[model samples]
Target: MRLSRSFLPTLKENPAEAQITSHRLMLRAGLIRQTSAGIYAWLPAGLKVLRNIANIVRAEQDAIGAQEMLMPTLQSSELWKRSGRYDAYGPEMLRIRDRHERDLLYGPTNEEMVTDLFGQVVKSYRELPQVLYHVQWKFRDEVRPRFGVMRGREFYMKDAYSFDVDYDAAVDSYRRMMLAYLRTFQRLGVKAIPMVADTGPIGGELSHEFLVLAPTGESGVFFDGAFEEQDWLSEAVDISDRESLAKFFARMTSFYAATDEKHDEAQWAKVPPERRREGRGIEVGHIFHFGRKYTESMDISVSGPDGAPLYPEMGSYGIGVSRLVAAIIEASHDEQGIIWPQSVAPFAAVIINLKNGDAQCDEICERLYAAAPEHLLYDDRGERAGVKFADADLMGHPWQVIVGPRGAKAGIVEVKNRASGERSEMPVDAVLAHIGVGA
Candidate 1:
């Protein structure tokens, strides 16, 4: 991607409306643009990051045996009505009417719809345990939507529904998702503490919210420091075995972590002083085991092994895909701009041509771009070196390969680490090796 030819519209000054670091940096770095109060137009660079985050979320969910599928954004109001929530959901539910005067709604969540669909397909306990998920756009009418994507009216979300024949099986499904969420955030380079949280409108007996710590987070959170050392992917869990699943669930739940709403002073005191970690946090994901809440309300039933009618216990897991873009920025940005993790970085690196018109500089830049053009952003614009450096820092490329006239002539280039600000001049081949790029 050539900088001059790209559609990136970076701002020189911060927008007055951006009250948070992620919001300001997102705008200044040309990642997103506000189309309305809380709705945004994800530009090319922004969309790339969005897709990368979604892909990671998808992969983690898939690893846990969740099947990916597509769910519509618009839904029948009748579905909510069947679940006894159409009226209860209130103003946040965007109610509408089709040309035929039938009631419709922009779905905020898919609980009722998924319940109805699953009930129609699976009639017996043999299909008891099933998990389905989708990455889709959702709309909820917030009275005062603010803080960029964090509290937006329209957002991208990954919602998964799990159905099981009984309570124990349903709990196992919830714990599996909790493990998946930990691994997902670990890969994304964020520390998201799993905190006990309220079920709210989802109406569940058990719930956990994955919150990423940031100075400007909306929720106050407390957790044990042991959460910091967990390697979720490496921790082996035998989900097929009931005892193993129970043990895994115990390990995850042993930590003292809770949001403000669920914080218990007596329980919090039990944690050793040295192990206590307190901070404000932004919720990135949530998992709920609501049992037969939806199934009972919607009259969804399946036959047991004995041919007895039974309501499948259910759980719902959600990851705010679009909001994570903002949450990641909040958790990992410096004053310059966003410090993106390699797993979800839009581009692996950016090559800045200090002398764009100079033959030597252009040759080096083009060569690097040719190696992996899709993963590299080349600054070929007629801009000042300072401007190029500033923009590269603001955009938060992991590595910046600088090709000035002097280094280009010497068949060498300067490579700078975006996070560490470490600079080194090396042979072009060495530069390629350092950036993990090649011919």
Candidate 2:
């Protein structure tokens, strides 16, 4: 991952078309490039960050017993027709025709397709409860797509479908998935408040949208600061027990959090003055409890204990996998560039050879870079020290290991924290220990 050899095409000036902080920084930092309006080609660094976010989402979903599977990007229009949404979905859906003149579509969402697939199997109540998920690319024909990946027409997404035998069981699954979303955002080093939200085209009565607060966010947000104090991973809530899930859901909803569209003045006044938190927010994830919306529309059913046909209650959970990259930047960046969380940073640290050709400096950087080649980016380019410093800050690795000639000669190096802007000289061994590189 040498900077000189890497395909990172960082720009000195911001792209004029970038209207948002994340969009401008993403372009100038060389994370992504626009191939067309509202579409992008993720570069090496960007793809790595994308994969890291997806991995965190996958791990959290897996922890909650969701089975992972892959679904096609293209789907038969009949799937939507059977669900009675073929004409209702509108222009955002990309309607297409194959050579055979069959009506098809690029799926904007997978509710109908998943319902049909699940119905094809599991004919009895014994297979009543199931959670299936997939991380894949999705396309939507946004009329005015902008804001980089934040509102891209083509993006990566993680969508999960849950099937249960009844309304109560579906509610439990919804609550469980909500807890998982909290854990997922926490692991990604972002505070996302779950607010009651409209289901939109997903057509669910119960819904929650997770919003990450940022000054450049599109939605006005109101919330209680108590959400910042929650440690969902440490909380003892058993998803297997119905009572426990209900209590967990109650505790989560107890916080007064909402976007301007759903804000209630009475609820806001109930919070302590000092604990009130108001800001703008960007949506990163959403979950829905639609009960039998899809199952009933598509005529999907299972056998009940009494030998009667029963429509399975269902829910869908979604995380904007690609949009999160921009959202994280929006929430965390400073004037210099993106301050990536360690969990989702493309590289854990960048090793800057202040004097690239200097024997001592080269020796130190190469040694450190060799220790974790996959996780470290070595700035071995023959660039000025100031240039290297600026680029390191722009790229926003969690840490920057500075190997200047002065320190390199003494078998020491200066370690700088990207977020705190703190630099301290430490022995070579101490540097490895601080960066979690060796041992």
Candidate 3:
């Protein structure tokens, strides 16, 4: 993508309303714009990052055999009524009325709707174990929506529903999702710790919220320091093997981890003094096993082997796809701007034409741009060298390749690593090679 022709409306100063670093940086970097109190319009650069994060989440979900599907943003309130939550889910639910005066709502979550769908078509135990997921927009009317997209009223989410015949089978499905979530966050360059959490309106005894530690977080969390060192990605997991799944579950749950709501002082005392860790964290993902909660309410039943009618056990998993953008920035940014991980970076490398109109610089930048990877963004805008450099840093591309008059004359370019702030002058071909795009 060429910056000169792109719709990146970067700001010269921070927006006064943005209270957090991620929110402020997102505005200054031209990633998003607030259309309302908590609703945002993602610009070109921000949309690219959003899509990248969505793809990673999709891939990880697929790895665990979860089939992807799309669900509607608006749902019939009748479905929630059937589940007895139409009235229970108050203010946060965006209630509305259609022409016929029927109650409708922009779904905050999809438990009741998915349960109704499952009850209609799935009647036999043969379809007992199925994981279905969708990436869609959701709306919740937050009384005080602030901190940019981090706590937005309208945001994108990846929600999955799992159906099983019984409690044991449902637990296995939950374990699979836990593992998938861990791997997903790891690939995105964040260490998310799974802590027992309140089910809230979802209503279940078993629930976990994955929190990423960040100084700007809203929730206080306590956990064993060992959680910081554990590598969930290295462990082998067999989703279909119940014994293996149980072992993994035991290993992870054995740790002392809980959010403030669930934290116990007695439990903290049990751990060695050096292993205790208390800090602020951002909630990025949540999962719950609500056995028969939705299925029974919605009449989602399957025939057992003994030919008895039984309600299917179910669980729901959610990841805040849009909120992750803010979370990533919150956890990784420096004074300059965001430090995006390569997996979720909008652009892998940025090509800066330091001397925009200079013939030699233009020739080198154009050549590199032609050979650059599809993920690279070429900054050929007619801006000063300092401005171009600052923009490149603010955008937080993993690498920056600067083509200036002096460097072009010597057949060299300055290659800089955004995260390390390290730079070295190399032959133009070498710079291309360093970016993994050989000339």
Candidate 4:
């Protein structure tokens, strides 16, 4: 993508309304533009990053045997009513009325709707274990929606529901999901630890909220540093093997981790004093087993092996897809701009033509673009070298391959690592090799 032809309307100064680092950088970087109090129109650059994040979430969900399907943003209120939560969900639920005067809502969550979907199908124990997920926009009318996408009223979310015939089977499914979460966060280049969350009514130690640590986060978090040393991807844990899943889950949960709400002073002391660590964090994902809360409330029953009605044990897992964009920036940015992790970066590297019209500079950039156009963003705009450099750093492409007249004439480029602020001058092909692009 050529910056000269792109729609990245980056701001030289930060927006006054953006009070947080993620919010300010997102505005300055032109990732998102606020249309209303909390609503945003994701610009070209923002949409790409958002999609990249969503794809990663999708892949990990698929890895855990969860099937993907699309669900409606505007859900029928009737489903909520059947579960007796239509009135109880409170103001966060964006209630509305259609032409027929039927009460409706822009779904805050999909538990009721998904439960209804499950009840309509899966009539027997043979269909006992199933997982369904969807990535879609959701709305919650936050009384004070601030902090940009981090606390937006409208956001993209991935919610998955699991159905099982019994409590034991449901717990096994939860462990598998937890393993998936750990692996997903690792790939996304963030340190996320699952903390015990408040399971309101149906409870027995089956709730967890995955919090990504950041300096400016809202919630206080305490966890063992052992979480940082484990490599989830390299662990030989098979999802289908219940024993493997149990061991993996135990390793993660055994660490003393808790958010402010569930913080236990006695438990904190129990953790080895040397391993105790604390920080503020943003909630990125959460998974909880609700047993038969929804299935029983909605009277969703399937025939058991003994031919009697059995309410399926249920759980809901959520990842704030849009919120993650802000969260990643929150956790990774420096004074200059956002330092995007390569996996979720919009483009792997940006080739900055320091002198756009210069034949040598243009030739090298165009050649680099032609070699790996999909992974490269060519800064073809007629701007100053400083402007290009600042913008490149602001957008946080993992690498910046600079083509100046001096290096261009010599058929070489200066490759700058965005994260490290390290620079090395090398041949064009060597630059490509360093960034892992085939020439």
Candidate 5:
């Protein structure tokens, strides 16, 4: 992870095609590169961030008892046809034909495929409640894919499917996902408000879109200001207790929040003017309670207690795993560059050898690098101190430990907080302690 040997291709000037802060910073910071209109190749630094985000999503999903299992990027078009969506999905679906002329597609979503799988194996109500998720690449042919990964045609997503025997059970599954999404965003250092949203092609009457407030966000959202103050993490989550889950559900639904598609002027006007907040927001996650939509269409049925054949109620939850990289930048960057949250930061800290070839600086940086975690990126490049500092800021590591000639000679180093712009000169051992690395 030495910067001198790393593949970070930071740019000095903003790329002209980047219309948003996240897009510009992503390019300038060398996190990603556009391979096509909306497809990107994640470089080393970008891939680290992507993995970090995926890990967070995985942890939160696991907390709610959702099992992780990857689905394929390419799916047979027959699956979509079985669900009656092959024709309905239209242009966004990347339709293709194999050499033998069999229809195929890069799956935009996995509802139909998951349903088909569920129907084959899960027949009894004993397996009534199940949540399976995957972090995988998805393709959607956006007519105008712009804003970097924020609206990319090819992107990574964490999509989960929940199957339950009936509507009531499905609602519970939706609540679990809602809580998991809140916890996921909270751990990522972002406040995402759950707003009622249109189900769109997913075709669900009950749906919630988790939106993170950002000036450059595409969706206009309105909500009660109280949502900003609510701490979803502090509330106890008892998924096994139905009453407790219902209580949590009640608390979340009490808030008045809606995206443009679900906005009601009369309901919004009812809020006191001071409590009303209208702002642009990025949709980071969505959950749907689509009772029997995919299951019935795809013949996914389970045996009821009364021995009747019944289609399982279903829900799908999605998090924009790749888009979150851009969303985080949009919500947290300053003029210098991205200020990554520690949880999702590619590197917790960057060690900058301000005087690269200087013996003392090199010694100090090398020592710190040896002790730091594998994720730490040591900037051992022979670049100017200013350039190194600027690049460190642009790359958005949560902290920067500068081993300058002066500090190195003094047996000290300067630890700079990327977000606060605060620098503290301390003994090398203290620097190690500050960064949670043993000397």
Candidate 6:
């Protein structure tokens, strides 16, 4: 993508409406624009990051046996009514009436709808276990929507529902989903620890929220630093083996992690004082083992082996797909701008043409750009070297390939790691190798 031709509308100053670091940086970096109160239109760069996050969430979900499907943003109010929550959901739900005066709503969550759909199709214990998920836009009428996409009124989300034969089976599903969330966040290049959380409107007795630690986070947290030492992605766990799942669950819970709301001094003291870490955290994902809350409320049931009707034990897992963009920025940005994780960066690297009009500089940049045209952003704009450098840093690509006339002429370019601020002079031929791209 050529900067001169791209629709990136970066700003020199932050927008007045943006209060949080992520919101302010997102506006100035041209990643998103506010279209309405608490709503945004994701620009090219922002949408790329959004899709990358969603794809990782999808892949992790699929790996855990969850099947993906699309669900409507608008749902019939009848589903909520049958579950006895239509009136109780409050102002956050955007209730509407169609031409026939039939009631409808923009779904804030899909527990009731999913329960009804599952009951309509599955009738017996044979198909007792299933995990279904969808990545879609959701609307919630926040009285005061703030913090950019972090607390947006309309945002993208990935919600999955699991149905099982009984409480024990449902618990297994919850553990598997937790493992998936850990793997998902690890791959996305963020440290999100699971903490005990209230179910709230989701109405579950067992719940956990994944919080990404950040200095500017909303919730104060106390945790054991051991969480940083464990690599979830490389940990081997057999999803089908209940004993393995239980051991994994036990190990995760063994860590002392909690938000201020649920903090326990007794538990905190149990950790080695030196290994204890206190910080602020932003909630990015949540999982709940609600058992028969929805199934019983909606009267959804399956026939047991004994021919008796049994309400399926269930669980709900959610990841704020769009909010993660802001969360990642909140956790990773520095004074210059966002230092994007390679997995979710809009571009793998930006090729900054320090002398855009110079033939030798253009030749070197074009060569690097062509090596992976789709993954590279070529700054071919006729802007000053300062503007190009600032924009490259602001956009926060993992790497910046500098092509100045002097270096270009020598067939050597300077490569800088965005996160480390480390620069290396490399042969033009070695640029792709340094950035982990195939020649």
What's the C-alpha lDDT at position 300 in model 4?
91
Q: Which parts of model 5 have CA positions greater than 4 angstroms off?
A: 437-439
lDDT of 6 at 213: 86
lDDT of 5 by residue, 1-439 (tens): 9887889999999999999999999999999999999999999889999999999999999998999988899999889888899999989999989999999999999998888877888889987798999999999999999999999999999999999877888888998889889889988988889999999998989999999899989999999998788877687879888788889999988879999999999999888999999999999999999899888888778898988988888999999999999999989998889999988898989998877678998888888888875858998877787898889889999999888887788898889899888889999877767866554
**Per-residue lDDT tens digits of candidate 2, residues 179-277?**
999999999999888998878899989998999988888889888898778765576989899999898888888888888888899989999999999
**RMSD (Å) of each candidate, 1 decimal:** 1.3, 1.3, 1.3, 1.5, 1.2, 1.3
Model 1 CA lDDT for position 307: 88
Superior by TM-score: candidate 5 or candidate 6: 5
Better of 2 and 6 by lDDT: 6
Q: Write the per-residue lDDT of candidate 6 for residues 144-194, one digit (tens) a residue.
A: 999999998999999999999999999999999999998899899998999
Model 1's alpha-carbon lDDT is: 0.90
Please tell me which predicted candidate would have the highest lDDT against the true structure: 6
Could you tell me the lDDT of residue 215 within candidate 1?
89
lDDT of 2 at 411: 97
Off by over 4 Å in 4: 200-205
How far off is model 1, as Cα RMSD?
1.3
Backbone clashes, each candidate: 0, 0, 0, 0, 0, 0
TM-scores, one per candidate: 0.97, 0.97, 0.97, 0.97, 0.98, 0.97
Model 1 spans with C-alpha error above 4 angstroms: 437-439
Query: Which portions of model 6 miss their true places by more than 4 Å?
Result: none
lDDT, candidate 1, 79-197, per-residue tens? 89889999998899899899999999999999998899898799999986999999999999999999898899999999999999899889889988888898888888888888999
Could you give me the TM-score of model 1 versus the true structure? 0.97
Deviation of model 1 at 407, angstroms:
1.4
lDDT of 1 at 361: 87
